[model samples]
Target: MSRLLSSLRDGKGFDIVLVAVPLAFLLVFSGLPLIYNVVMSFQAVDMFSLGTFNRPWVGFKNYVDVFSLPATWPIMRNTVIFVVCSIAGQFVIGFALALFFARGFPGSSYIRGLFLASWVMPGLVVGAMWNWILAGDFGVLNYALRSLGIISENIFWASNPAWSLWAVIVANIWLGISFNMILLSVGLAAIPRDLYEAAALDGANGLQKFWTITLPMMRSTIGAVISLGLIFTLQQFDLFASITSGGPANSSNVAQYWAWEMSFRQYDFAKGATISVVMIAVVMIASVIYVRSTRHEVRG
Candidate 1:
């Protein structure tokens, strides 16, 4: 016992203990719940059988049923649109801002730090704030657009079926921009200044330097950023709940929000679980990409 204690205090035993604790925690909390969810997806689950794990198994019927619904394809389409647009907008704007601030201008650090405020705020809070800005009659956005002659009238951002999804997408892009900027800024900073100087001496213009030096070096970072953005965007539910509620005839419904609506509002637990399982598969793919990207970065 004394030897065991000694090993734990100052040997590989300590490292084993460090790993074991978190492993145990994950198995209990994350792993078990994930297994349960998958099992539920295959079983016949409803409000009545929700309390027990002894429900009848239905195989892939839930998945078929979920897809057979008229709303499924449209919601999936919205999800695709939301994910693509949000990621593109956030990454482009964030990359631009990262390059701008990477110049290390006066007060740049302070200004960059302030941008993190958007990322730190809760999704619900951000949605509520954007709600006011997107209001049709007295919205700040409409006023600005009108003042700029971009539009002659107020736009009902959250209500109109045409604009509802876009309203949520815009808010999501705003929420994610700071996070993308910070990660991209780190990547930019890691690039050796000597490379740029060498390129400049060789008659490389700014555009040439960016294409030749900056992009190749940032490959891993970009991959990781886009994969993570997919995971986050797929899991985005709070913004839907607070901003659109998947409303206006389900024009803005996405997979995550639809899953919640099925589980709680519609009391279709099996279908909800099936939807979640599908999303889990997509997120797992993104996770693999993220892992590969980070591993490549570490090797570099």
Candidate 2:
């Protein structure tokens, strides 16, 4: 029995300890908050009333309010549209940029800092910078557009509801391309050159090689990058909040900003919790599909 204990406490036990740390954090922070939020969503949590101790038990009334409100549908619809368009745009743009970066350039190392600098900047800062660039009157973009005969002298980028969504989407796409480029670049680098060479010998041109060899080889990496990007973009708040404040007449309001409005601006904790819960469910559903499709390995 003592000899058995000694062996258990060596290599196997060391691995066990390593796994335990993340598990402990997941339970304390991620797991507990998820459970608590679910509970809170079901209750009548008043921002102002009996402190945290005594609140009425309201089962799904908050959810009902969330569903029934006229404003809610628009926000939700907007979120869906934003998420879909942004995801599609990012996939296309990022994939192209990744391919570009994979072909090493004379100054690719220096250029990476220039291209990915926007991504590494704080979200709020990115929002502010993009806001200025996309602004109607004095924006550099407008100036260039006018100079190049794209739009007259004055064009409302965020003013029209039709264009406002696209404007925000463009920003999100720009932000997304960097990470995707970085990951796909790494994936491309990790590929055994022999595979490409063999494909070339077998009459596979550049297009054929990419479709058959590069994409299939990088499937897991691409999946992880795209899925995580969707999650982050779906929960986007800082950019919308900072640049538009869900504004130009609620046109830019996403699920996260709507929840922010409920909790922080409107001082309605119950509604906020309700929105938070729903948003969480949306993210989790995406995550589930991602996991199922990608077969992501569960890391201990």
Candidate 3:
């Protein structure tokens, strides 16, 4: 016992045990559930046999049925639009903020830290806040637009099919901005000051320096950011649940929300699992990109 304790305290055993614990935890909790979800996707699951794993296997049937649904394509399109617009908005705005703060102006760090308040807030809370702001009448957003003379009347953002997805996208972008900004700030900080100094000596202008120096150094970080954004965007369900609930003829519906609606609301566990499996595959792809990006990081 003493020898084992000694090894654990000051030897390779400590490192092995340190790594093993989280691996074991992940396998039991995360890995097991993920594997079960994939398995359930291929099975003909009913409430009667849900408690056991002996349900009849009906491979691809759930996938077929999900695709055959009339709302599938429209929901998928909304999902695509949501992901694209949210990531674009978050990245552009976040990058701009990061660069601005990187200038080291007065209280930049303090101000940047404050921005994380929005990101740290629970998604449900953010959704609820946005919901109030997006109310058709007397909402802050509509009031602002009206005050600015941008529109003639109030727009029902969460109810109108034309604007429902966009409403969620706008909220999602705000929620994600801080995360993108912080990560990009770290990336920008990691870049050596000497590079910029050298570029300045070479008579490079601001745009040329950014395009030639900052972008190259930030390649890996940008990849990691974009991959994580994809994974998080795909996993976004809480905002939809709290704000729209995939309502108004499913205009704002996405895969994750639809999966929950299927499993809980519709009691179609197989189809829900099928959707989850598809999502898992997508997340895995993003994970691969993140891993590769980190592997190729240009350390300063």
Candidate 4:
């Protein structure tokens, strides 16, 4: 017993213990809940049977019901669009900003730090702020566009079915840009300056150097950023709740918010669980891609 205690107190056993604590915590908190959700997806669950573990096993009936719903495909399509567009917008804009700051202009670091403010702010708070910005009557966006003669009339960004989805996407992109920029900036910073110097000696211009050197070096980081972005986008619920609430005839509804609406608002727990299971599968695929990307990372 004394030997065991000593090993735990002063040896590699201590490191194992440190890892075990968090692992145990995850098993109890995260793993169990995830297992329960998966199990629930396969079971017929009502509010009455929710408290008990023993429920009717419905197999894939819930999944079938989920797919049979008329709104399912549209919501799934919207989710895909939201995820793809938000990621593209965030990554493209973020890469641009990262490169811009990588130039090391005076006060660039401070300005880049300020951009993190958007990312750290609560999503609901960001959504609320954007509410007025995208508002129809006196929103700054419309006002600016009208001032520049971009639109003939005030656009109801959040209310109109055609624009409502895009409205959320726009806000989501803005919210995600900071995170993407910060990660990409780190990736940019990790790249050896010597490579650029070598490329310059070889008469390589900015574009050629970026394509040949910067991109290849940052492959791992890009994969990580994109995978994390996909997960974050899938888990995004606060913005939907605050900004759109899946409004305008559910034009802006995505899988996550729709899952919540099904489980809580309408009490269709099984279908909600089904939707979440599908989302989990999508995230798992992204995780696999991230792992594959990391395998290609160049060693120093």
Candidate 5:
């Protein structure tokens, strides 16, 4: 049995070699960081003790403090709002854009290119551009609105806590459509033209065709898009942080930003690690449900 096992390992040597570089990287970085964070979460270490060779062990205290935070519920709520609004809005806008492009009208290729450009742009760059566009004193958005007599004065833009959250949401919506449009375009392309022809012959209008044929036929694609979007949004940090830095008054604080603040800004590594662990658990639980529901095969 030992010899057989050794032979089996030898048989997989090439596969192991193929993944050796990535496996080594994951070990040195991802695995080590994850293990270290988990360990940190169980210990009690202050900023002064950060470099000390000796660290105190205080099981679950970090976690307890994490859950005990006054901002925890609000931050979690903001995270939910950010995830749901960003993903759902992006999905709808992307689907609509995909449908419009599918018509193959004039300049459709250019429009697709525009969507691709947004997708390719870095999130931080997008956020920085938005900060200018939404700037209070000299924002193009408020300028145009004022010129059109939509309002007498420029709004606070991102100054107010409530409005700042929406500002971030708006920025999210703008960038999010790219993912949906790109994915849905392929799904739209994969759909057979004959189905549309048959539906047209049956006196079905475009809306009817889309509802009865396009949507159902593209369920798997839609599921895949939603799943990826959910995963990305759940851990989203860059745009949110760059846009508001967790906000004018902490109103826009999401779980990601909170974790960053705890770990980096507050210099509380143990509590930060605890928050990271909790965030991982939440994401994993949600992803499990999402993956199970979106499974391709469901027949009993």
Candidate 6:
């Protein structure tokens, strides 16, 4: 027992123990549940069979049925739109903010810190706030747009089929902007100022310096941010639940919320598992991209 204690205190056993603890934790919590979810996707699962592992294996029937549903294609399309638009908006605005703050004006740090309020807020809270902002009547958004002469009438953001999805997307972009900005600010800070100084010596204009220097230096960060944004946007559920609830003929229903609806609300566990499995596949791809990007950044 003394020898074992000595080894743990000063030998490779300590390293092994440190790694093993977290590895075991992950195996029990994350790995097991993920494997179970994948397994459940293949087998026939319902409220009755949910308690046990032994069940009828339906093979690809769940997948086939999920695809066969009329709402499946539309939901998939909305998911794509949500992810693409949210990521684009978040990255563009975040990068702009990061650049703006990198200039280091008076009170810039405090103002930059203030942007994190949206990020730190719970998703449901953010969704609730957006619900008020996007309300058909007396909404701040409509008030602003009307004041700008963009529209004379109030837009029914949450109820209208055309605008419901966009309402959620806008809220998501707002919530994610600070995250992107903070990450990009780190990347921008890492870049050697000497490169910019040298570029200026060569008479490179501001646009040229940004296009050539800033973008190239931030490539890995950009990749990592976009990949993570894909995962986050795909996993977004609270906004849909609080804002639109996938209402008005499932106009804003994405895969994540649809999976919950199938599982809990409709009690179609097999279909829900199938939808989750599909999302898992997409997230895994994004994880791979994020890993590669960070690895490249470290290597550089």
Could you tell me which residue pairs clash in candidate 1?
none
List candidate 2 segments past 4 Å from native: 1-29, 289-300
Residue 244 CA error for candidate 1 (Å)? 0.3
lDDT by residue for model 6 over 60-97, one digit each (tens)? Answer: 99999999999999999999999999999999999999
Clash totals, every prediction = 0, 0, 0, 0, 0, 0
**Which ranges of candidate 4 are over 4 A from the true structure?**
1-3, 9-12, 298-300
What lDDT would each prediction earn against the true structure?
0.95, 0.81, 0.92, 0.92, 0.83, 0.95
User: Per-residue lDDT of 6-25 in model 5, one digit per residue for the tens?
Assistant: 76578955565668789999
Q: Candidate 2's C-alpha lDDT?
A: 0.81
Scored against the true structure, residue 260 in model 1 reaches a CA lDDT of: 94
Error of 4 at 235 (Å): 1.0
Report the lDDT tens digits of candidate 1 across residue range 22-112.
Answer: 9999999999989988989999988988997769999999999999999999999999999999999999999999999999989999999
Q: In model 1, how large is the Cα lDDT of residue 205?
A: 100
| Whole-model alpha-carbon lDDT for candidate 4 | 0.92
The candidate, 1 or 3, that scores higher on TM-score is 1
Candidate structures ordered by TM-score, highest first: 1, 6, 3, 4, 5, 2
lDDT (tens digit, per residue) of candidate 2 on 1-300: 776568667765666567889999999999998887788778887667426767778998989988999998898888988898888888778788878877888988678657788778888888888889888888888999889998866767777776787788888888877777776677788789999999989998999998998888887777777778779887788888767778787898888889889887887877888999988887897797678646742330
- Give all TM-scores, in the order shown: 0.96, 0.86, 0.94, 0.94, 0.87, 0.95
RMSD of each: 1.6, 3.7, 1.9, 1.8, 3.6, 1.7
Q: Give the Å shift of residue 263 in candidate 3.
A: 0.6
Off by over 4 Å in 5: 1-15, 285-300
